[model samples]
Target: MHGKIPMASYDEAVASKLRRVSTDSLRFGIIALIAFLTLVDLFAAQAILPSLVVKFSVSRATMGFAVNASTFGMAIAGVAVALLGRNIDRRNGIWFSLVVLAIPTALLSITDSIAMFALLRVLQGLCMSAAFTLTIAYLAEHFSPGQAAGALAAYVTGNVASNFFGRILSAAVADGFGISINFLTFAALNIAGALLVWLTLKKTDRMMRIDADHPPVGGAWKAHFKNRELRGSFAIGFLILFVFIGTFTYVNFQLAAAPLALSPMALGLVYFVFLPSMLTTPLAGRVARRFGPANGIVLTLGIAIAGLLALLTPNLPIVLAGMALIAIGTFLAQAIATGHVSRVAARDKAAASGIYLASYYSGGLVGSFVLGQVYDRLGWTTCVVVLVAALIAATIIARPLTAPRV
Candidate 1:
């Protein structure tokens, strides 16, 4: 009888151990945290742009391009990873890329020339792309099919959260300590990201080693180019960021220089505008499902145009309201357009995404320079007019993104 009782206790203990080992909640948190660290440094530089201009003693346009040069490297890395990711080990690539990322982010503090600064920014972009690319792969491999959707949603929420909080942190650190120290703070976050991934993430046995039998990129792209919906999506993807980057980049100068005269900390807090976007963007897939991608694009970009017009208001509250609308509209539009790309490509979908991202970020790089010149020469109102025109063009391009008339 005693021996039988001991066996029952042993079985109960085993069952309890199995129950204790559930990692679903932990996995979601880890994925979101790592994504946040990966992208926290991306656009945070914009918060400190005024300080950087003073530090480098350079033109606003020059500083703007240098600050945005990260997009250039990101564009190249997106395509490279799409082609080469099958060979990369997701577990090691994510952690190691973050470690390397810290080096460039730290080095940014000591750079003295615009040329070098831009180069380091490019390096940062490369490391971030590798980490982000591999993380997406990791999610697909690690999570169950039932859990993958929620996991991806968590990762994207982290990215959006970083955009909102990262800038605030950067501005606060620069205001209190110094701009150089701000880079060091970000470097430390990079190290934390590496350690987090190293400790928690696991490798999957189901490796997607497909380079041995992959299709030719040149042939695939040619086919993708022939599709009208794909073509329209690619263009909309480009124009979305063109207007977004243009409006956000130059508006800082206007806010800091004139009647508003918001301090660095205050300007950083201005990104509170993204809160509505954070809330609204998660519903983008639902919006597309209900209204269809074509109508979703038109509806959201219409909100953006209304926001651009509101920027002409003389009142501060109205101006902030305008910025909030732009954030909500553009972010939702981007989510819709990105989802459209995934649907319309039909084959080599990863490569199609790579092409779309390259075009999207390239628009940001181009917008930084083009709109900087516009702001410097023609002033804020002309810049708003230019952005409004860009959004209008994007709306026209998105019209053909569907076959059935909407």
Candidate 2:
């Protein structure tokens, strides 16, 4: 009878904990909402580029400058946040960045000149990147290593959701109401997300304050880089997004040409294959906890490689099936790598995450700019070959993560 009583009490306790688990959802939703607001513009711009070119009487190449500008800004902001803004409170950093993001995003609606629009995009990128970097570092620092894996998975899931839905939503708005309305609507959402962050996510984790009190900016990098495993994490981080951005960037061009010419709406729907990553990414944390981060990464990258190979065939269903696999693998790899950074960096966790993200966004910048030309000159097959090689290199770089020390 007493054993039965204890078992009942234990079950009740578990139920109580499950109720509190809803808070994680709240926090995840707020962070995800903010990410969605900022990233929607990034993906949506691709769909709206033709409208932009027509509106400004500019060349397609010139219209691309805005995206490139934002990518550059994100890279610079990531570095700056890592090095210069080490002491900023995480909550306040996010709050400030959100408010700043709202201004530029709103300004984007009213800006007439292409140069001015590009400038606003750069500003928005700076603020958005800072917000994202800080939120990731905050999530990593607050949770236990195993739990951090889950938290980071949710975070990346939010990012994947943004990638899938943001583009679709933004493109729809632009199609229905014109480009200005799209920017204005996104700007309003940014402000609302900022308010939610400020009101609900009010307190910073105390551990973060303790961790931030470490070596100077350069020394912090030196400390993280000194760890061989962390360095591999950074490299893997760079390469994961490098291939992701590169593939998606050029696939649009490929789909728009030849026998498989697809409309803009169809292109956006093609990205829907990535929607599964919202499921696959969160599961990544569980995979890492069970299989170890190293093995999880290798498995996911292998899947990505296979997906890229599938693209070599000219069939649309086969190509899309390949893309879905690539998206799943990329998100899983990123979630594992991102969570591993938080686990492995013994100190200056923010710096570690910041540098990792800096590497990530830099990969995006380089892949889009450099590989766009690669596609233009060498064609889709060559681009796919380059991405496959890069994924293999990422798998090699991530091998150290399997070591006992890691």
TM-scores for all predictions: 0.91, 0.86
The 10 consecutive residues of candidate 2 with the worst lDDT sum are 204-213
Error of 2 at 325 (Å): 1.4
**203-266 per-residue lDDT for model 2 (tens digits):** 6644344254666667878888888889999889889877987887667666766788876667
**Residues 134-165, candidate 1, lDDT per residue (tens digit)?**
78778877777778877877788788888888
Which candidate number would show the highest lDDT if scored against the true structure? 1
**Residue pairs in candidate 2 whose N, alpha carbon or C atoms collide under 3 angstroms:** none
Which residue pairs show backbone clashes in model 1?
none
Best by TM-score: 1
RMSD of each: 4.6, 3.2
